[model samples]
Target chain A: MNRKTLHVVFNSLFGIGGFCNAILFPIVLETQPDSLAQLLKAPVNFLRQRLWWLWPASFLLAALAKFADKKICDRWGHDAVKEMLEILREKGFPGNKEPVHFHRVTLFKHKRWWLCWRFWPWSGWLVPVVRSGHTTLNHQTCFLAPDEADHAEGIAGRCWSTKAVILIPTEDSNMTLPLLNPEVNAKPHDPHAMAEIYAKETFMDTDWVLKKLPHSRSFLGIPVVVQGQPWGVIVVDSRATKIQCAKGILASYEEIARPFIKCLERLS
Target chain B: MTTAPWIQVEPSLRMRSEPRQGLQLTLFVPPHEVPQAVRGEFDKQLKKFVIEIRYLDDEDFKRETMDDTVCLRIGKNSRRLLGIELDTANLNVAQVQFQLKEVEEEIKRAVTKFLQKDQAQEERENYALAIKAIESKGEQLLNRSILAPAL
Candidate 1:
């Protein structure tokens, strides 16, 4: 059986066993202390006393399954993105001077009640579930890895919020990529125009999107939609800038969303 | 009719639908301009030709339908022409090739109409480049079915 089916079976069995034990185990030990003593004498219960650890261990397995699911999603996302990049190159996509990097910044909504204990908010953060690495760049330096973007911040977040494609180019050079609070405003499409461009989103800066790697001056974020809801943004970053404005190259990479969502639903 | 070196068009089969074997006609421009494609079932090519001049969000520009299939994207604030959306679903793109010249003329006319609305320097330049791209690539789309390769 599939892992999911196995998990469901295990859960149902565990639920029934736990319910029976919740009442029977305590009652049996209370009325017949000798039975409890005999059970404790078993070799398996040597360290765990009454062997109550089994209950918590079962729950631990379920938690681990969740963590594993995230890892699996990441692995799948990475493969799909890499394959997509390859397709673009083969199809003669007019790309950038520097190697272009694409990331799937998914909105991970912490829906489960158990997830409340996590540091994440109920609304969830726009985390880079699938990240790509290159020779000149490291995955950690991207706005993902260590710190994810808030649902209302950055080009990716804004795309999610507006459900639109947000393109911030370098040749026009508007954003500061500010690591700090909002600062600077410029005319039309200058470095300071971030204030006007990001009038709704206060954190419209990216000076430190790459703390260690080379700066990503141009950004094109496309909102990924599935079943009429916003899922995430396909973030394309170019080191040489001008991915959109003033030539350099305007690619039709927007269709990457097609293969992306396809892989998501395929169960592959 | 040729595009400037700065503005380029690299045509690629950006998306192929499921079902493995079916005819899909994409009189396509390279897939730039829009942020993404709304995933849907397109058994036959959507019978549309979309040339997104600038990549834009839905709110960035307001789409004004010139006709049932022909539409122009106008910037929300600048009011300049942004792009063209033509629904060619019923139109046949085949080897017989009778409609190529007519289709090209219609496209040129539509673009000219959009450019005439605004005479700004930026609009003028955009008009030139867009025409060049259409002229250069419109022929490749003219005589053959975009799905010829698959066939």
Candidate 2:
């Protein structure tokens, strides 16, 4: 059945079960006498009584109703996201005309320290859930610290801010030159140069202020927005600097990010 | 066990000579600002770190001293460790790791600021040198045309 019809049937069953428990069960229990003999007799009377079956029937219905609830949640958990994407194609998503696409879509939840990502065909299984809050700074897998501002693995964490992006302090004039222009920092520059600069600089400053992660030398980060407000960032990094410089990487990152935002919106 | 990098320095002769010796780092709290009890309580929360408050007078005032200041000294107990006196004020253990992190950030900021200032100065010097070269070349060209061969 369609979602709307299923929703209606579930609500009606729940309402009838709630009314029976709240009104009928109490009236029947209270009318029974205090004496043991009368209590023993009560059961026989209930068997003959007009509304005696209603109490047990209500409980049975409530159980069935709960089962339906779980079933709907499990079914919608996967399909709702797919349906939302189809809707985005027809009606358009908040501001963007097209969806974002990166290697995998990541969702950084609000208020919670954990972020989750589920790949296609993987369903709910084996999604890498990154918990930055519980992670120690020097831990082998701990790349992002809880307190640190957002940054792609390749670029120095200090480079970009909501206000401005500073020049990477390196011997390479090319990297520093591009960042000096405020406009270039806001938008991605020549893909090849950015990839090369980020990779070399990350390697150069391995022990420095940069938050270094393995095989994440070439990187791009785009803000994942929800309802015009900044929710979290979608960061894509690559070990291969040469591959990152190829055209369309930035657009792909944006495309992958869009539906992921829609999924967060639906789940929240 | 190897000593942490932050504890590399030896205590100054003055500190070593002191009767009551322990590891100590003093924080400069401006005069009449933070109460001695509050400072003591903060130190107590650190558990292993002991807190001592010293009221500063004119004689005690050094170039580094701020007005209305008290110093908090954190150190290893003399009874616990024989004679490995630490000269450094900053704690380096995992318990005080955040403080070490702050020190790292402070160093990075100082270095970045120094480099930026140095770059600006170099840019100014290069601009001046370029102007001087252009002026000299123009002068030589004029001199050759007016006083020597025009060819």
Q: Which stretches of candidate 2 lie over 4 Å from their true place?
A: A1-13, A21-102, A111-217, A227-230, A237-263, B1-151
* DockQ for each model: 0.03, 0.01
lDDT of 2 by residue, B1-151 (tens): 2111111111121011222211211111111111111011122222222222111100111111111122212112110001111112342323322343432233234333433544633322222322222222322222211111111
For model 2, the docking class works out as incorrect
Q: What share of the true interface contacts does each candidate keep?
A: 0.02, 0.00
Task: Write one digit per residue (lDDT tens) for candidate 2, span A159-183.
Answer: 1122111112211222222231234
Poorest 10 consecutive residues by lDDT, candidate 1 chain A = A105-114
* RMSD to the hidden true structure, all candidates: 15.2, 25.3
Best by lDDT: 1
Expressed as tens digits, the lDDT of each residue in A1-268 for candidate 1 is 6656655665665565565456544553455344466755454344245537655654565555555555453355557765664544333324324344432222222121213222344444455544444433322222221133343555565555544445554223344332222232132244344333333332334333222222444455555544333445555554433343311122434535455555654322
